[model samples]
Target: MKIVITGGAGFIGSNLARALTEQPRVTQIRVLDNLSTGHKPNIAGLDVDFFEGDIQNAVLLDQVLRDADAVVHLAALPSVPRSLRDPLASHHANTTGTLQVLDAARRAGDLYVIAASSSSVYGANPNLPKHEDLTPAPMSPYAATKLATEAYLSAYHHSFGLPVLSFRLFNVYGPGQRADHAYAAVIPKWVSATLAGQPVTVHGDGTQTRDFTYVGTVCRVFTNALLRRIIEPRPVNLAFGTRKSLLDLIPEIEVATGRPAHREHRVPRVGDVSHSQADSTRLLALFPEVTPVPINEGIAATVDWFRASAVIAASS
Candidate 1:
C-alpha cells in the first residue's frame, strides 16, 4: 500500500511516517510538508519520498495524492495562542487547506483519507469526558478550524462518496515534539526548560487539565486505521479517558528528570480551555487493541528524548 502523509515532517507526522515504514504492507510512504512548523530533519533517515510544499496548492496536492492508497492529513497551523493572534491564517491553513486536500483526494480514485481534528473543538461546552455527540462550541479560531476540518471530511464522505475518517486528537506529546518554538506544547516546553535549569511557565495557576495521549499510541491507531481501512463519518475522540492537571504533571517531570521544577505561575491565556477529557467509547469500540501508555512512563520517555536532543545539539 502506498500512503501519503500531509505535514508528514512535523511532530506527529514524522512519528507516523516512522511507524508506517516498519509495516510490511506499506510499500511506499510519501510526505508533503512546507516546513513552516515542521522540520525536514524530523523525517531524516526514513524511507520516504519527501515533497516540500504547502497543502493549499491544488497542483501540489494533486501531484502528491496521485496513485496513493491512503492519505493521512496532519497539516495545520496549530496552537490556540497563535490562532487567537491571527484567525485568518489559521482558517486558511486548517480549514481551506483541508478542503483542498479533500478535493484532491476525490480526484484520486478510491483513496482513503484520514485527517486529524483537535479536542479543542469542544471548547466552552463545559462537559467532562467530551463525546462525539456533544455540540462543538469552539472558543478560539483554532478550535473553529478543527471543527470545520471534521465537518468537511463528513461532507466529503456523504456527498462525494469519499472514504474518510476524522480523529479528534487531544494533547498528543512524546519524542520528536519540539520545544524551541514559542507555541510549543506544554510537555516539550516544560521538559526542555526544567532540564535547562530554568523555571517552567505555568499558565492559569496550573489547575487546568488535559487528556494527554502519547504520540506512539496515536501513530499505532493511525497505522491500524489505515491497514484496516476504517471509515467513520462522525469524528471519533482519539484520546483515552485520562485527565492530568498541570500540577499533577509537574511532579512527574521532576521525578523523570531528577530535578525540581521552578514554576512561574502567570495569568491564563485567552481562549484556553480550563479542562479537557475524552470519552473514548467510540474509539475503543473501533480499536480495542490500543493500550494507553501511562502518563509517568510517557513523561520519562519524553525527558530521555529531550536529554538526548540536548546532547546532540551540544555535540554538533
Candidate 2:
C-alpha cells in the first residue's frame, strides 16, 4: 500500500510516518508538509517520499496524492491561543486546506482518506466523557475549524462516496513533539522545563484536565484504520476515557525525571477548555485491539526522549 500523509513532518504525523514504515504491507510513504510548524528533521532517516509544500496549493496536493492508496490528513494550524490571535489563518489552513485535500482525493480515485480532528470541538458543551453525538459548541476558532474539518470529511463521504474517517484526537504527546514553540502542548513544555530545571508554567492553578493519548497509540489506530479500510462518517473520539488534571500530571513528571517541578501559575488563556474527556465506546468498538499506554509509562518514555535529545544537542 502506498500512503500519503499531509503535515507528515509534524509531531503526530512524523510518528505516524515512522509507524507506517514498519508495516510489511505498506510499500511507499509520502509526506507533504509546509514546515510552518513541522520540522523537516522530524522525518529524517525515515523512508518516505518527501514533498515540502502547503496543502492549500491544489496543484501541489494533486501531485503528492496521486496513485496513493490512502491519504492521512494531519496538517493544521494547531493551538487555541494561536487561533484566538488570528482566526482567518486557522480557517484557511484547517478548513480550506481540508476542502482542498478532499477535492484532491476525489480526483485521485478510490482513495481512503483519514483526517485528524480535535477534542477541542466539544468546547463550551460542559460534559464529562464527551461522546460523538453531542452537539459541538466550539468556543475557539481552532475548535470551529476542527469541527469543520471533520464535517467536510463527512460531507465528502456522503456526497461523493469517498471512504473517510475523522478521528477526534485528544491531547496527543510523545517523542518528536517539540517544546521549543510558544504554543507547545502541556506535556512537552512541562517535560522540557522540568528537565532543564526551570519552572513549569501552569495556567489556571493547574486544575484543568485532559484525556491525554500517547502518540504511539494514536499512530497504531490510524495505521489500523488505513489498512482495514474503516469508513465512519461520524467523528470518532480517539482517546480512551482517562482524565488527568494538570496537578495530577506534575507528580508523574517528577517521578519520570527525578526532579520536582517548580510551577509558575498564571491566568488561564482564552478559548482554553476547562476539562475534556472522551467516551471511547465507538473507538473501542472500531479498534478493540488498541491498548492505551499508561500515563506514567508514556511520561517515562517522553523523559527518555528528552534526555536523548538534550545529549544530542550538547554533542552537536
Candidate 3:
C-alpha cells in the first residue's frame, strides 16, 4: 500500500511513520512536511520519501497525493495558546491546509484520508467522558479551526463520497517531542523540567485534566483508520480512556525521574479548558486490539527518551 503522512516529521507523525514502516503490506511511505514545526531529525534514518514543503501548497499536495492509497493528515499549527496568540496562522494551516488536502484526495480517486483532529474541540462543555454526540463549543481558535475542518471532511464525505476519518486525539505524548517550544505540551515540559531539577510551571492550579493518549496507541489507530474503508467521514475519539490532572501527573514524573517537581503556579492562560476526558467507545469498537499504555508507563518511557536525548546533547 502506498501511504502519505502529512507533517511526517512532527512528534505524532514521526511516530506514526516509524510504526507504518513495520507493516509488511505498506510498500511505500511518503512524508510531506514543511519543517515549520516539524524536525528533520525525527524522520532521520527512516526508509520513506520525504518532501519538505507547505501543506497549503497546491502543487505540493497534488504531487504527494498522486498515486497514494491513503493520506494520514497530521499537519497543523497545534497549540491552543499559539492559536489564541495568532488565529490567522492557525486558520490558514488547520482549516485552509485541510481543505487543500481534502481537495487533493478528492481528485486522487478513492484516496483514503485519516486526518488528525483534537479534543480541544470539546472546549469547556462541563461534560464528562466527551462523546461524539455532544455539541462542540470550541473556546480557542485552534479548536474552532479543527471543528470547522471536521465539518469540511463530513461534507466531502457526503457530497463527494470521499473515504475520510478524523480522529480527535487527546494529549498525545512520546519520544522525539521537546519541551523547549513556547507552545510545548505539558508532559514533555514537566518531564524535562523535573529531570533538570527546575520548577515545572502549572497553569491554573494544576487541576486541568487531560486524556493523555500514548503516541504509539494513536499510531495504531491511524493504521486501522487508513486500512479500513469508511462510507463517510466521522469523528472518533482516540484516547487511552483514562484521564489525569496536571497535579496527578507531578508525582508520576517525580517517581520516574527520582526528583521532586518544583511546581510554580500561575494564572491559567485564556482559551484553556479546566478539564477534558474522552469516551473512546467508538474507537475501541473499531479496533479492539488497541491497548493503550498506562499513563505511568508512558511517562516513564517519555522520560527515558528525554534523558537520553539530553545526555546526547550534553556529550556533543
Root-mean-square deviation per candidate: 0.6, 0.6, 1.1
- Return the clash pairs for model 2, or none: none
Better of 1 and 3 by TM-score: 1
lDDT of 1 by residue, 82-177 (tens): 999999999999999999999999898958999999999999999898999999999999999999999999999999899999999999999999
Tens digits of lDDT, candidate 3, 1-316: 9999999999999999999999888999999999999999999899999999998999889999899899989999999989988999999999999999999998788588888899999997889889988989999999999998899889998988888888898999988788988999999999999888899998888888888988888887788766665444678888856988999999999999999999899989999988889997888788888889888898899999998998988998
Instruction: Give Cα-based local distance difference scores for all models.
Output: 0.96, 0.95, 0.89
Give the true-structure RMSD of model 3: 1.1
Estimate the TM-score for candidate 1: 0.99
Model 2, span 190-221: residue lDDT tens: 99999889999998888889999999999999
- For model 2, the superposed segments whose C-alpha errors exceed 4 Å read none
Query: Judged by lDDT against the true structure, how good is candidate 2?
Result: 0.95
Clashes of each: 0, 0, 0
lDDT of model 1 at position 48: 100
Top candidate by lDDT = 1
